[model samples]
Target chain A: MMSGSGDPAGLDATTLNCHELGLSFGGHKVLNGFSVTFAGAGITAVVGPNGAGKTTLFNVITGFIQPDSGECFLGDKQLTGRRPHSIARLGIGRTFQDVRFIARLSVIDNLLLASNAVSGPTGIGLRAFLSEKRIREEHSDRCAEVLETIGLTQKAGDTASTLSFGQQKLLSIGCCLMNPRKYYLLDEPFAGVHPELVVTITETLKKMSKSSEVIFIEHDFEIIEKIAERVVAIHQGHLIVDGPPDQVFDTDSVLEAFVG
Target chain B: MEYVLHILMLIVIYSVLAYSLDFIVGHGGLVSLAQAGFFGIGAYAAALLSLKFGLSLPTVFLASICLTALMSLFVSVPSFYLQDDYFVVVTFCFQMIVFSIFNNWLEVTRGALGIPGIPLPVLFGWEISSKSEFIVLGLLILAFSALCIWGLTRGAFGRILHGLREDEVYTESLGWNVRAVKIIAFAVSAVLAGLAGSLYGFYVAYIDPTYFTVMESILILSIVIVGGAGSFAGPVIGASVLVLMPEALRFIGFTPSLAGNMRELVYGLLLVLILLFRPQGIAGKYDFTQSKGAR
Candidate 1:
């Protein structure tokens, strides 16, 4: 566990810190020496072009893909090589770029499944069933609340596959509400969504950022401009710019890299 | 009539097998090819206990379930790290290994000759010798299995498995241990298959290495696929169709060998047609697109 370093740039008590992370697939280097410090409560947008390793960053941070080297910390806990579920249990939630959902299950069931992890016991067995009857009621209530917040209450009973692309993305976010983490890694949340839903998502992220830290990867500079307090720019697996949104946007080298 | 009772018994037993596979292949999206191995382990365990040790049927059946559960740990541990074709290959190897044991362990299993004279199920000191009594026993077992399946799919455990089947990465991100859930699902599936095997051994009163071959595993897989994989009624429908098809073929007036070959051809044709035209099967709302990799 690494915590409470007095340096101003150090990670906060409820933040995620990655140091010297590296990864390679087959013979290609996807990430190398990637390091960033996310604070406790703000939106840190990972703005980059396609193939910039943004999703890779999320995968590494969430423990889906182990880095060749370097360590990650959530709060005081060292989460270098932990399993994804363990990282999630430590209060880190994530959404995929492709918007993965249990398509056969209803929207409500998807949220209910997520809620079970937070509301139910940790282990699998008779204990999970015997805990109490009230837990079920609590789970249903929480699922309803999240669905309403995402404006998906009307489609709660519908299968997730039947929802519009924008609604599906919102449902994906709502699924994470069952166990709201202190850190969120949202991978291209607005990739294919409509402009109206974009505003709704931005507002939702703003509200989420008030209580938790958000590390999102977005291609849309407009959305980045509206939501990002800080932006880290990557080009071809290398970090080129990192600072305030306007400052990074103003850099001549970043503009050149984007154009070239 | 006795033959009809025997077929009904097999339907009940195979229904359990098909439903159990539904969990791994249907819900977890792991297409295991080792179910017959677990099934054989149950049958042989019961057969060995009854013939050699003269144990009662109920005691032997319970012991058979425990044995298969322990065997499941061996496959489940390795399966946690493998997926898709590799997982299928490993399970295929396991099925071969179980079959080999059945054929080579002469002292215990009597090799291919198998163990015979297994006592019929006796409940409350009444031997179920008559066909009606056996049918009653089979129906009761089917009812209990149906209850178990219903309880599992409706509960929190089933929800987690469904999530894993749909999108394992998303499930993992939601704080669910994907591997552990998969292992549990596999184990439960094995336990049910083992129960079916135990019942099968007692009902047939004969056990042999030939009964637990890879072809048998394929037959079980076909039943799951043709009936609909994830739905509760899928296995029952699939098992009934598969079990009754061969019997219905008796009226074709072909030689025994030709009839057997035709039955196999029909099974193959049905499987291919289902895969091509209706991958969802009869009752399934979800297609095979939610397979393990899709997750």
Candidate 2:
């Protein structure tokens, strides 16, 4: 494995910035005038209490939910109100908090599906049919590499539903790894994970953060402290703290929000 | 010899219908009940064009595919928003609408009295009026269709279809246009069914509203489920067994009246047994319900 400090300079260094993002669900405000800028490299943790709009933030950023009034940008590229797949094609890889996957597909097949650049809607014409074997082999090689990185090489042929919950979570992250996106949005990658697998996943993410920007929403402070160099915390639909891990965790308002 | 050729020809036509249904039901996880509507559209279009307009076989075939694909949009558009049960209901309604049009539109469809004396195509100045000669043409089309379906399902498009079947939302997040996938798959299936319909019209030299019904759609669905919905051999195997079983019953000393009812009974019994013993189908990879009890 390569070192995690290789200047983090493979993808485009386009920072994901949100400006005055506001949203409400039937009069209950989820995110009110939320704004933050995420670095194009390194691990940035988004932490928040329940109903603090952390999930909503990721949804809006990923184009799953259109904010009431605000805009998101990757450098100068406008992202607001775009479809999820459009945003994904625009270089954003995201994993769901619930660890959703194509359960019927094989473990390696899931990874193969992730690489949209290489695996999207190939033609069924004469030439395409002739080159299918080569295409499949190339994708299989990439999937094998991803399976090895995720420590799931043994289960490559198994259906995804047969994998345990934590393994499914790793497989989900492995799917994201197959794509070379500018930003990675992982929602609660650590939640409900076994400690040993957590260590494996954490190391995998750390390695990935070196080449691409990794933005993850997490609850475990220990995990956030271990991987997150910068922390952006939200409280009740607002950005209450944004700084280094030590400073953000030590803030009185963050402590109050957690306790009171 | 002619009787056997006739049975085999019907098997080939139904195989096309079964596999077409598999594309939507098995790959896309959509249970469309309007397949017979598309099938009816193809047969009527082919029959009318060949008889009234004197169009060649190629023209009628292309027209049939185009017409059925256009009609398939009625089902595919709703699938974008409706959930499972509701989607089935919508297809059922569409099937009824098409059936009513076939039965009532006396000007074009001739209502219950389907178009007769539908002529077979003459190729290379040779009239393919014999059953054996028609079987050759049928097998060639079947082989071409099977090859195309194989090429399609083995590629990236097929993988995306599998993803749509499992989890559509996750597929969208992977940079796939889920709506477009569903619509394309539905159209492909409709076109295939339409091709089969045109072939059936030409083969029998007749067309009728009674041949295309919701029950026909369910029969094709059973072929997919019994033979293995997602598996390549499933539709072919299912279609062969289903088409031959009724013919076999007649040879076993049962009268034609009893044999007809017996065939339906056997189909129901076989389906129940398959669901109980092998819910994943004969060669299927997916468990449709995915329940613990099924495993």
Top-scoring candidate (DockQ): 1
Candidate 2: give the clashing pairs.
none
Give the per-residue lDDT of model 1 (tens digit) for B1-295.
8787788887888888998788788766778889998989888887878777878877887798778878888788887787678988999999999999999999999998988888777777989888778777767777877777777776677778778777777777888877778767778889888888887888789999999999999999888898898888998999999999887887778788898999999999988898899998877645774454342
Question: Which residue pairs does candidate 1 place in steric collision?
Answer: none
User: Tens-digit lDDT track for model 2 on B18-124?
Assistant: 88899888877888888888988989988999899988888888899889889999999999889688999999999999999999999998999988999887665
Instruction: Specify the highest-TM-score model's number.
Output: 1
In candidate 1, position B45 carries an lDDT of 83
Docking class of 1: acceptable
Note the Cα lDDT for every prediction shown. Answer: 0.80, 0.83
Cα lDDT, model 2, residue A223: 88
User: How far in Å is the alpha carbon of B235 misplaced in model 2?
Assistant: 0.9
- lDDT of model 2 at position A162: 94
Give the alpha carbon lDDT tens digit for every residue of A1-260 in model 2: 11111222342347677888899999999989888877688888988898899989999998989999878887667789778887887789899988888887788778877764323442122222334466568778778878888999999999888998899999999988888888899999888989999999999899889888888998889888988888888997889988888999999999888888
Which RMSD does model 1 reach against the true structure?
3.0
Candidate 1 lDDT, A20-45, residue by residue in tens: 77888887888877777777678888
TM-scores, chain A, per candidate:
0.90, 0.90
Q: After the best TM-score superposition of candidate 2, give how far the Cα of residue B283 lies from its true spot, in angstroms.
A: 3.1
Total clashes, candidate 1?
Answer: 0
